[model samples]
Target chain A: MIRTAVIVFPGSNCDRDMKVAMEAVTGSPVAMVWHGDAEVPACDVMVLPGGFSYGDYLRCGAMAAKSPIMRDVIAKAKAGTPLLGVCNGFQVLLETGLLPGALMRNASLKFICRDVHMTCDNNETFFTNCYRKGEVVTIPIAHHDGNYFASDDDVARLEGDGRVVFRYSDAVGNATPEANPNGSVANIAGISDATGRIVGMMPHPERLFEKALGGTDGRRVFESALFSVTEATT
Target chain B: MKAHIKITLKPGVLDPQGKAIEHALGSLGFNGVDEVRQGKFIEVELAEMDEASARAAVEQMCEKLLANTVIENYAYELVA
Candidate 1:
């Protein structure tokens, strides 16, 4: 059985939800690693779930990014372990330098809470392989600081390298100004690093995985990543 | 030694809060307030005796934790 670990800081409110979601799909126990711990422990995939880590002090994920366990997380990331960071987790990954770009205050300066449509930009990566290219998926986004910022050089590099995985779009999957919920550059809802092993995104895919809640479009993110890893290993 | 650090977003970066403040000031009939930008002020006390070393330490802190240099710039002054 493969293991997945979910890192939990003091103020993390989504760790349990993520754990339940992963367990339901993977049929294995997911470890909830504490922020104060020095080691992340060995896991196939490590998750940094969304929440107000460190009570959103200084910055959304700043203090939590410097927490003790991050040293291990960074090491593992460098050694090629796949990582998925959601919402606040995305901010933390940016702060940790595992992923590029900073998530600033939303352009509206107000907390956005609603479902947003996103399109799969690249289905070749381990995380999005389950969805066809340009597939539209509905995911809930809840945050005040989901605006992504990056230097022009890096943006060009990311685009050229095919690292942008998801972009906000309309119901028909058209990228437009009105479709951009938080003013992210190019309507990027999620991005993968150059290696495509790590992903950070602002949407809450775990929150609406079951159709009973609203939609099951979010399930393929985990399923596809699983397919990629298990197939590669075999 | 005491270090006072100020962190501000780069000029090109959008400051929504600052913009809101500017709008509020305009509504209050304040004249000639062309632009307003906001930043953070952080004060830290350290026991380093040497000024050069204190400045170096604070600069390192700014790079590592005090400020995110990617979008924000930070400057520190040593006091007393």
Candidate 2:
């Protein structure tokens, strides 16, 4: 059985969604870990769900990144545990230095909440193995600071390493300027660490996992992680 | 001691809010505006009495939490 842990920070509104989605997919109870805890339970996957953590003080995820639980999360991620950070969780990952780059205010300077098309740039990672590379999927994004920025060299390196997991794209899979939702560098919507075990993305997969909610496109993300973990263990 | 901190986005990093403010000024008939880059100002009260220690602490704070060095540059001044 695949076990999952969902870190819950104060003001994190999407923790419940993560818990529900993981349970629904894995058929196992997920542990809801408080941000104050120093250690996380043994689990196959860890998820940092979306929300206004620590009221998004100082910066979007600056305050929460320093939480006690993050130290353990960092250690676990470094040890090859699958870690997925969505939305505000992505901000926390960047602030914690687990992921390179910074999320700045959107070019439009507006809180955008809508469905956007993104092409799966790489599907070999633990978090995206279920997706076919270059497949276009629609996911909902709701944030004001989802514009991803990195140094020119870093962007080139990420692209070269095939670590750019997803890119904003049109319905037909063309990554056009008009398809860019938040002015992210090179139309990047999500990225992974060099090892591909740690992934951070601005889109919330848990929010769109069920067809009743909207669509099932996001379910494959969790399925992919679970499949990867199960494959590694077996 | 108080540490006055100024955090500004690094040169070449896009600042959408600053650009919006610049456009607003243009609409208000203010001419000759070159560009606008927005930043943050923070005042932190330090319990340390020694000037050197306070300065060091403030610098660490800027590096660790107050400012994200990835896209921002921070400068600070200590005042009695």
Q: What is residue A139's positional error in candidate 2, in angstroms? A: 1.0
**True-structure lDDT of candidate 1:** 0.89
Candidate 2 structure, TM-score to reference: 0.98
How would you encode candidate 2's per-residue C-alpha lDDT over A1-234 as one tens digit per residue? 998999999999999999999899888899999999999999999999999999999999999999999999999999988899999999999999999999999988999999999999999989899999999999889999999999999999999999999899999999999999999999999999998899999988887899899998889999998899789989
Give the runs in model 1 whose Cα sits over 4 Å from its true position: none
Query: For residues B3-54, could you state the per-residue lDDT of candidate 2 as single tens digits?
Result: 9999999999989899989989999999888679999999988886899888
Question: In Å, what is the interface RMSD of model 2?
Answer: 0.5
TM-scores for every predicted model: 0.98, 0.98
Q: Tell me how far the alpha carbon of residue A18 in candidate 2 is from the true structure, in angstroms, after superposition.
A: 1.0
Model 1 compared with the native: what TM-score? 0.98
Give lDDT per model, in order.
0.89, 0.93
TM-score of chain B of 2: 0.95
Model 1, DockQ value?
0.79
Question: DockQ for all models, in order?
Answer: 0.79, 0.94
Which candidate should be chosen as best, given DockQ against the real structure? 2
